[model samples]
Target: MADDKKVLDDGELVLVKDYVEEIITDLKYSTEDNFTLKVIYNYSDAYLRYGTVKKLKKAQEIFKKKGYRIKIWDAYRTVEAQRFMWEIYPDDDFVADPNIGFSNHNRGTAVDVTLVDEAGNELKMPTGFDDFEAVMNYDPEDEKNKERTENASMLNEIMTSCGFRRSTTEWWHFNDTDKYPVVEGFNSII
Candidate 1:
């Protein structure tokens, strides 16, 4: 690490876009297309904790070998943004309670992501980002979801292989809490 001042200034978060090659980003909160139907973030950059970025880079290396790239939807949300999100969608199962504490995203240890092909097209999963419905809940035994399940499984394998764990509620979400401690508050990705 550099100096404490630098680390604190940067919020101990690295811009994953700067470290990873060909990483596609589509931060929904930065635009009006998200669940809130309003622009929340002032910018579109994505960020993760220093340790989380290392895991994400390793996962991306594995994905590239298999002809896929990572597509990030959200990462390192600010506390203000989290509060706005919770006010819009107060479901504990999906959105974390800002009053209680920051969620994985707010901690800068979680990422909402899916895989993309060599052509930069997103791979189909159970559902889109922030769906927050039963469809987002994945089950391996469901015959109807074989295709979706397989895609989700592949993503889980890639992420887990690099020290990340998939969220049971959202396939696109992953955390690196076991290997790296989650940092609460905000990383100033906005």
Candidate 2:
């Protein structure tokens, strides 16, 4: 571990499902469904900084009232996992370069999420998760992408309103405004 990095204990990180039961979690990195096409995580639970989880819980409450739910795709990635993803994608826009610095997800203060309907079906967005072509800030005036833009906009609005900063490149990625040091030694396993 670098001198600048901190090792967060389990107390500082909480399982997303434990914090917000209604929010669905599909940890894509735990399976071969992600861009890496390999399981990057040994466990499947999504974890985030406790403060970040609180914001997500608030977002989930708001979504519940609006007949939608949050589905988390990724959270709290280890530096090893980050390196593996970088090797596969090698795109700084999508995957953070561990050599330069760790990602917010490595700090447990960022998450990849999408909005799902009451039936747990994901809403139509500009593109699927980890799709590099997906732009977070799409042209709302473009009629061809009206529904996709609207859905992405709604998700962005709610997530940002709950104290998360939206990623300009990825529609599904959000970072907590409250900063936390890059964490080390934590894995997806319980």
Candidate 3:
């Protein structure tokens, strides 16, 4: 890792809210609402690499000007959490297999996010967070899914323009192009 890079294990991870207050956070791992059906994180605040947070802040500013707001679902997952998630859903498509390697999220370089209207209602997207079935069923070309496709596309474009790469499988997931080492033995709680 670069000398200036921040990692969760080193206690240098940054809170997303501290840099981008305009971005709303609803960490699914911190609640039972996730596919895991369990609370995986003890902290409610979202944490990410400082550089990744800067990219997110840029995206949030663009969303704000477009009459939308950014809502983050997950960020900066610990290696232990990655292992737990893999045990529950071993599918490599959505959840990264800890045995092979950790996810970009485990390195604080990936984030799952969505767009919300001014009223805080989520915009119509192809699928909700962590819904692999919905992703498979979605057809971006179908007229029935036009609005959803458009919203998802817009989110992808803005995020990519701000230095994040969209996941080919998960619409809400984005990874920072800059690489970072996986954070091991880091407590998720603030």
Top-TM-score candidate index: 3
10-55: candidate 1 lDDT, tens digit per residue: 2367777766756888888899987789887776888887778877
Give the alpha carbon lDDT tens digit for every residue of 104-173 in model 2: 9999999999999999899988888987754545566889989988999899999999999998788899
Question: Alpha-carbon error at 115 in model 3, in Å?
Answer: 0.5
Model 3's alpha-carbon lDDT is: 0.88
RMSD of each: 4.0, 5.8, 4.1
TM-score of each predicted structure versus truth: 0.85, 0.89, 0.92
Q: How many residue pairs clash in model 2?
A: 0
Please give, for residues 1-190, the per-residue lDDT of candidate 3 as tens digits: 1333433342257778877889899999999999989998788888898889888988999999999999999998878788899999999999999899889999888999999999999999998888889898888999999999999999999999999999999999999998888876776554
User: What are the lDDT scores of the predictions, listed in order?
Assistant: 0.79, 0.86, 0.88
At residue 18, give the lDDT of candidate 1: 69
After superposition, the stretches of candidate 2 with alpha carbons farther than 4 Å from their true spots are 1-11, 134-140, 187-190
Order the candidate numbers by TM-score, best to worst.
3, 2, 1
Poorest lDDT segment (10 consecutive residues) of candidate 3: 1-10
lDDT score at residue 26, model 3, on the 0-100 scale = 96
